[model samples]
Target: MKHPVTPDGRYFVVRGRLWRMSNPKLDETQRSKLTNRLMSARRAVRAAKTANDQSAEAAAHRAVDDAKRVLGERGPVWWNDGSPDLNRHLAKNTPYAEWYGQIGRSRPGGT
Candidate 1:
C-alpha cells in the first residue's frame, strides 16, 4: 500500500520503495485516521518487543488488532493472512522481502 512520508514528499511503500500510486489523494479525516492506526501498530510492536514469554503473542495480536481498528476492515484483512499462527521459523527461514513476496503470491493484489 502507498503511505505518505511527510508533508512534502509523496507516498511510498512500507519497505521504502517508491509507490506506483504517486500523488494519491486522501482526505484529512482519512489521513488522521490512518495516522492514528499507524501509531497503534507501532505501540503493538513495542508491547510485543517488551513481552518476555508466550504472552507476547497477546501483545502481537493487540498490535494487529489496533492496526485493524485504525485501518478498519482493510487493515484487519491485511493482517489476517496467517491467522493465529506465530511461527518463529517464518522469521528465521526468510528475509522480510522474501516473506512479503511469498505472501503476495499467496494473496494476489493484497486481497
Candidate 2:
C-alpha cells in the first residue's frame, strides 16, 4: 500500500492535503535545543513589544523562523524530491483534487 507520509516522516497526507510534521530524525538533544531557541525567541518577541525594541523584535523573529525552518515547519522542504510542496493546500483545490474526494471517504476527520 502507498504510504501517506514521505520516507523521511517530514510530511504526511490527509485527504490529499500535505501537512508538514517535524522531522522525526531529530535527536532528543537537538530537538530540546531547538525548542529552547524557539521559546526564547517567542519570549523575546513579547519583551521587545513591551520595550518597543524594533530591532530586537526583528532579530527574535528571524531566530524563531530559523528554529522553525530547522524543525521542518517552514522554509524549504526537507525532501530533496522535485515535487512541489502542497502545504496549506486543500485536496479539492490541488492536482490531487480529482481523487481527493474519493479518499475523503476513508479520511480520519472525514471533512
Candidate 3:
C-alpha cells in the first residue's frame, strides 16, 4: 500500500513513523542504478541467509547500506534547509504531528 508523504516531500510516513526519501536532485539514471543495486544487495542477503553464510550476509548488508546512503535515503538529509533528520521518528512526536492527525481524521473509519 502507498504511504503518505509529508508536505515538504522530505519523508513518507509508514505506521506513523517518518522515513527519509531519496534525493530529488539525483539524476534519473543514477537513481535507477542505485535502486537496482540495492535490490540486488537485498537478494544477496536473502541468499546468504538461506545458505547460512554469516560473512556473506554481513557483506550484503553493508552493500545495502552503501546503496541506501548513495540514494540519500540514509546518511544525511538531502534538503538544504538544515532541518534535523527526523527519519525513523514517530510523526506524532515531530513537527508533523498535526498533519498526521489530520490525515487520520480524514480517512475512512478514522477516529
The prediction achieving the highest TM-score against the true structure is 3
Q: On residues 1-111, what C-alpha lDDT tens digit does candidate 3 reach at each position? A: 278889999899877899999999999999999999999999999999999999999999999999999999999778888799999999999999999999867867542
- State each model's C-alpha RMSD to the native: 11.9, 5.0, 1.7
Local accuracy of candidate 1 as per-residue lDDT tens digits, 1-111 = 343232223222343242222223556788576667667766766766677544765766676665544443233222324543222223223333454455445553541
Residue runs of model 1 more than 4 Å from their true location after superposition: 1-23, 53-111
Estimate, for each residue in 1-111, the C-alpha lDDT of model 2 and write its tens digit. Answer: 253654445555664576776666789899889989989999999999999999999998999989989987788776677867777786577666555566566656654
Which wins on lDDT, candidate 1 or candidate 3? Answer: 3
Pitting candidate 1 against candidate 2, the one with the higher lDDT is 2
Whose lDDT is greatest here? 3
Reference-based lDDT, residue 54, model 2: 98
Query: All candidates' TM-scores?
Result: 0.34, 0.62, 0.93
Whole-model lDDT for model 2 versus the true structure?
Answer: 0.74
lDDT of 3 at 5: 87
| Native-to-model Cα distance after best TM-score fit, residue 53 in candidate 2, in Å | 1.6
Worst 10 residues of 3 by lDDT: 102-111
